[model samples]
Target: MRNHTAINTFILLGLTDDPQLQILTFVFLFIAYLLSITGNMTIILLIFVDSHLKTAMYYFLQNFSFLEISYTSSCIPRYLYSLSTGDRTITYSACLSQLYFIYVFAITQFFLLTVMSYDRYVAICKPLHYVTIMNRRVCRRLVIGCWMVTLLLMLPLFILLLGLEFCNSNAIDHFGCDAHPLMKISCSDTWLLQQMVVICSVLIFILTLVCVVLSYVYIIRTILRFPSAQQRKKAFSTCSSHMIVLSISYGSCIFIYIKPSAKDDVATNKGIILLNTSICPMLNPFIYSLRNKQVKQAFTDLVTKLYSSQGTREILK
Candidate 1:
């Protein structure tokens, strides 16, 4: 066992050790971060301004957009700074805060995705009762409940991590502070913390995945029973975008967190985290909007309104 002492700061090794690669990485990440922020912000603004989008589906989407923005912000700016300045040192408190938020957003995303699957299920399987079942009050409650439960589940884990003592090693092999790396660096015995993380992660993944799977199963069944081919196609289209997002989200998550041997593959893990934190968020808005007709129309309408407003302002001037 290493000597017990408090660690005041931790160094992130970041994506690469090559100086040229670091500059390239900074540019790439900056562009990706900008795209993610713009895309998600556009989705949120469109949903808010368009009365036609004031439905349960769009409501959940707005929440997801906000979550993506916050999730990416929690990790990417620090990473960008590290790449730009060659300074990978993060204060201890900042590391803890980042770790706390990473867990909260990640867990909340799973719950929210599961909720979205259920919403799709209700909309497809019980079309006649969609509005009645997914009422405004219920949607609000479900969103609130997802946030509340994720926070409650992650708080204890964060508190447990805070109690740990880090001594000799303060270098994290990844771009951001995560549970496994933090555990590996700490001098104190982390068996309890590790067990808690493993158990909590498994439970969250399994429970949410089970819910999504069951919901989709029913959804597929309901779609198949529809007499009209066009109707089935429409229903399937509505679901395909979500199914794609779910697969990618859960696939990356399972590989990163659930795999027993994941720790040994630090390079692959960091690559996956980069994709998850940056690329995936950047893709989400485009995936949903391009696939959904309503969102495209809303975007067009928004642009038209902006142009018209500009014309009106010119006339007044």
Candidate 2:
């Protein structure tokens, strides 16, 4: 039997070892990270400042943008830093911390997406009661509930991971400190932890997916029943962006986490996860803004107001 010594740091085998690939990867990720921050931040700012965006839909969207920022920030920056500097060694505590935040932010996002689906459902199906059903107090409670539920689910796995001792192999075969990679390299018997991971993941995935699907089913049925074609078109426009975002989010996650074959293809999984972390977050704000008329209008109004104010200041000077 090999000696199992507790290690303070673990090495990350990043996306590629080729110097050229590393540079390309760094540049791509840097741009993606920059765009994601800028886009999501813009959404948050617009929602906060725009009076027209004070409804429940924009409120949920604002929270969702924040979650995207937190989730992407939790991992991508570290990976980019490693690719740039060749510093692959991450302290055990930092690794665990990364794992915790990634899971928390990601899981909470799933819940928030589910909630947003419900919000869309209410807005389309029960428009008369939408305001009463999704009041400010209820929205706040739902956001808090998502975070609480995530923490409860993650605490068990995180505590169990802390008890594990790493021995022979300290090289994680991924860019970030993911649970599966960490568990794979541990000397301890991780069967229980592995089961817990799968169970938690499957439970969250199945539950949230069911909620989203059901919400859309009702939403679609209601939209179809509209008497006028114009009304139907307008209703579809309201939620189409959300539907697209949902497809991308759920599709990527299902491929990465739920597929049995994913564990075997570590390299492919890494690529998919890179897209999930960087591209998806970067694309989401664009998706919402480009497809949303109200958001576009809000952006235009904000810019015009700023321009007029600047002109006034210049004249006064």
Candidate 3:
């Protein structure tokens, strides 16, 4: 549909065009989205209720959870509706909005993960100064700075996208409206937009990854200085989960943006996006919360407190 005509609506050719497959896809995505929502909310609630969990680490974790909930919600619900109802048409404004917020939140993920790495670095490499360095005011400023930076990074790209004319081809080959797919269908030359995306990707992904690597190097050195093997294992354990989460998140993102052409294989692109948007968010809660001993203890304590309260109320009655 690309011959110099403005497109009002786009049909998302989503993961599949098959009716049976659409039902299965809807079910799968629905369940995944539900789990992601539940898990992330649990993390946020646990951190908020448990004073012991209130630290720079959990503060970042709460922010990450909120971002994941917003990030996945941006696309999954629309995709599910399209699959279930067989109505894949999305308005131009709606598509652009989704694209905008997805990029916004995705960029925030990079920033937050970088911040988490720095927090770990301080906690492990400079334990004596950790509290002083990562104070409440500092953490708040860092998070606000992340969102501000993301807004600056995305505004130019949004303007560039606005200038492009979407002619006849209105069918997006993937599950949602991404920059690459939109560029492919645009009648205008996408060189500038492509360049902007590449530049920003490098700035966000590569730079943050370098920071995380450097932080870990210092962390490892500090851990090794500890005399006891048990101490070393305990120190590493604190960071191991975060590192795993970072790998999965960054690995998927790198594959998506580092490629010469993301739209070359529509099937592969959609599958990779599913992993990034759906699967990865779902994994974050488990990776950080379930595995952390403090979180488990907090959950147990909360449960016990609630139970005792209920028992007391029954006795009073």
- Please give each candidate's TM-score: 0.97, 0.97, 0.95
What do the candidate models score in CA lDDT, each in turn?
0.91, 0.93, 0.89
lDDT of 1 by residue, 147-206 (tens): 999999988888888788887788998899988888888878899999998899889999
Return the number of clashes found in candidate 3: 3
lDDT-superior candidate, 2 or 3: 2
lDDT of 2 by residue, 1-317 (tens): 54334688999998889999999999999999999999999999999999999998999999999999999999999998899789999998899999999989999999999999999999999999999999999999999999999999998998898888898789999999998888888988999999999899889999999999999999999999999999999999999999999999999988877777644587998999999999999999999999998999999999999999999999999
Score residue 250 of candidate 3 by CA lDDT. 81
Q: What does the lDDT read for residue 82 in candidate 1? A: 83
Best by lDDT: 2
Candidate 2 residue runs with Cα over 4 Å from true position: 1-5, 262-264
Q: Runs in model 3 with CA error above 4 Å?
A: 1-5, 260-264, 312-317
The C-alpha local distance difference test score for the whole of candidate 1 amounts to 0.91
**Ranking, lDDT, top scorer first:** 2, 1, 3
Clashes of 1: 0
Instruction: Superpose all Cα atoms of candidate 1 onto the true structure and report the RMSD in Å to 1 decimal.
Output: 1.7
